[model samples]
Target chain A: MTPLRIVTQLLEIAAALIAAPAFLGWVNQCRAWLQNRRAPSVLQPYYGLRKLFGKDVILAENASALFRFAPYAVFGTMVAAAAIIPSMGTGLPLSTAADAIALVGLLATARVFVSLAAMDVGTAFGTLGARREMMVGFLAEPALLMVLFVAAMISHTTSLPLIAEGLTTRALALYPSLAFTAVAFTLVLLAENARIPVDNPATHLELTMIHEAMLLEYSGRHLAMMEWAAALKLFNYACIGFALFIPWGTGTEAGGPAALMLAAPLLALKLAVAGAGLAVVETLSAKLRVFRAPEFLATAFLLAVLGLLVYLLLGA
Target chain B: MAPLSFDLQLLNGCAALLLLLSFSMLSQRRIVNLVNLLALQGALLCAATLLVAVRTGQGHLYLSAVLTLALKVVGLPLLLHRLIRRLNVYWDAEPVINASGTMLIGLLIVVFAFGLAQPISALASTATRSTLGIAIAVILLAFLTMITRRKAMSQVVAFLSMENGLFFGAMSATYGMPMVVELGVALDVLVAMLVLGVFFFQIREQFDSLDLHHLESLKETE
Candidate 1:
């Protein structure tokens, strides 16, 4: 890779890391506004992260070493995922590892580590959360793979960058398969990110919460890392969505560094519309019962499979 | 195959939406939602027919599209809504198989339909021929919905969806049947619907509920 390209990639990664929490803050603000509540500042997540990093971590009486290390592991995996997903350009050097299937694997690894650490301290809420989290991951992972598989079949490649580039430059863009997979991927995204209608990100009910349940035992920097990683995970998912469904603004098939520069504002615009759409969806739907989550994921899985079938039948 | 033009893509999207609506109906236990899903499916079928008509320059297909719009989208859903209100069978307690299991089977059926149509789709020269597999999938899913559902009204909904799938399959495979055949089928559907409306009251009068499980008791007694 050229030095200029490498520098551009690093800048993209850093921009993502810095912008991740702000994206979360934006979604929250939009959700608050839609719900007719006083909105929190768009910098709320940053302030929360800073305050979290400065506090002291409390240890459980029977805390294991794994509990101490899981935050870093999850945070590192999220960073790896963000690096691999093309934010502004699809041809970053790390794009080689940006196979959408492999990205799912990375997310699963982070999930497993966090769950293992959740159960390490022998807390009831921690165990409950970990169990629920694994269940969601188990169902969601296949639906995600199926979504990627449909996109891969369309572009005839498994590499995310190549898929993005190919789809961006392809002729006759009204793909029925892409349309079906987009719907499926949206469902998977909501479930994976602990968004509404699956698990409420903002909820902390003892019997219902999934992500927050796992973090009940974490404190200080570890808590900050976990929370920050979650935000980064959300950002990565949005980037992945852009790369697949709306890869036009990406600099992959366009001019060199200048295209990358232009892509930033476009990315922000897509994210703004996407985040507000997410908020409206969250505002509209109620959470399903824990038992009903499988059916929800099943709908996603079936939709993804149907997309594949459409591609196979229609060759679109 | 015809070129992947905007109209063809729009037709394919309509088929995909139809398939989705079929699965939605299969999983739905609320009668209101099931009826709504059926109406949506009818609307999609109307849209697909209109698209096929416009793209192929077939004048007859336009009449069929209007028929689908009037009968399936407007007439049947309105009739079903009134049937539901009068019969008070708004909640389907459960199905023979659960919602998710029905969906899993429905997915397999779709795959099977595509496989079944792969060879046939190759020989067909229609502009919308690619959607034949989806039409078949829609047909089988409607049948599955019929078999698994407990309520008789939903069974009737599933039956209408089956006819819808047949209509869509015919249109995709051959640009629709002769106009005479289309008119006859539409008349048959209206008659069957009216007859079933009468049958529902007879059965409900006898059993005090529309659940078809009550019919099993009428079998030969030892």
Candidate 2:
């Protein structure tokens, strides 16, 4: 509750809210460029969110309270997650309240709420989506935890900012464990955000969509919040990877106007590299079958565990 | 630490009761009685956590205690009850391992856990670290209960009871994990109970019984 950290947290939340839609739009733009197609405007996601937010929500007569409240819960959880992660600097106030492991739990809480709301509708697609979502969650959680555990072990602290600061400022010696973990974390990030090779976020095809399938019934502001939440989630996961693997250029805890100014461009450059990297991966890889997702996540988990073992045994 | 103060005695008694309930659960066959035993365990956990909170003045322990009360005591058992009612599986199903055999296994686990926890207990700075071995024993015994139980519902209860051991271990070793972690773990347990509740119905629907040996048939076919 230090005033300076509180101010940093508020600024970070505001930045995530403003930047998330643009990040999504940037990824779309990069995908289009890679595919040699005309690209949408950089602000297209933001515009879409705005239009949806201004419209009236239409709910099914059978919708329950869980269904109605899911979007808010989802959005609130993502907002909370963003506040805790150090997007611009390593001194977020909310960082004290939770660590990276709890961050994964927050995401899991949001996933559970959304999955329940999806199933509550009682449609065949909704149930299918809920089942698939839970399956993904069950497999993804351990991998995610192990990834965070690697970073935590390296820093000897679970605080996200401390992990970032420790890795960035530490000696430049190559840690093979972190190298494997970084790759594993990248795979998890892609799978979790519903990118290619695990899920096709762009397609609304019934048998193929995982994230989109759950959103079949949402419209208007509810849909907007969910989409914004989706974007926020993708942004958050990317920032988490950035904080862990590429911690350089994140401003220090002692806040100053110069640090803030430098952070803006550094963030933009980081986002550009990440968006393009995601597009390249998506373009190169094909989506795996639904049943095969367990194997994919299992590999991530094994890699993470292997990384932990290496770090523990060899102290690298 | 304080030459046997009231709070210390109450905390110790609560910890002892929690371990006793965990052992009873290891031997309990009837699902209904198992659920009741789990509730008792939760109550004892709440009392122990609250005593620690009051004694050490860590505000987060109070939240953890309330969470143990709500999720473990009230929430999960209720969910299990409803699942049992819906699945029509209140009666005792044959366990993969007999009760006496399971209790013997549990006794061995207790001894092993004490040996395993010796170094950790020595390192732990908390006054409750003496119970660390018990917490480990409870966790191992719960794991054994899950493995030996043929019924799916009983196994889920065992899984949840294992979480109780983990929470207690954290409390004894580190005064509880960070507040966010405790909350997240609580929410995770609640969500898991709900998901398992749904799974219970699905299992019964498919197999016509809550026996998980039916699920071993679900192994991947080439």
Please provide TM-scores, in order, for all candidate models, with all chains considered together: 0.96, 0.59
The TM-score each candidate achieves on chain A is 0.98, 0.97
The fnat score for candidate 1 comes to 0.73
Q: After superposition, how far is residue A217 of candidate 2 from its true place, in Å?
A: 0.7
Candidate 1 chain B least-lDDT 10 residues: B1-10
Those runs of model 2 whose alpha carbons end farther than 4 Å from true positions after fitting are A1-3, B1-222
| lDDT tens readout by residue for model 2, B1-222 | 113556665665566556557766876788999998998889889988998999899998898888888888898888778777777787667777765456556656766876788799889898777677768878998999898888888888899899999998898888889999988888888888888788877877787887877777756453
Q: lDDT by residue for model 1 over A1-316, one digit each (tens)?
A: 7875697679888988999999999999999999999999989999999999999999888988899999999999999998888788876788786578889999999999999999999888999999999999999999999999988987889888888888888885467778888988999999999998989898776588899999999999999999999999999999989999998888863478788888899999999999999999999999999888998898888888888887887787
Q: After superposition, how far is residue A91 of candidate 1 from its true place, in Å?
A: 2.1
Q: Which ten residues in a row have the lowest lDDT in candidate 1 chain A?
A: A251-260
Tell me the alpha-carbon RMSD of every candidate: 1.8, 18.9
Docking level for model 1:
medium
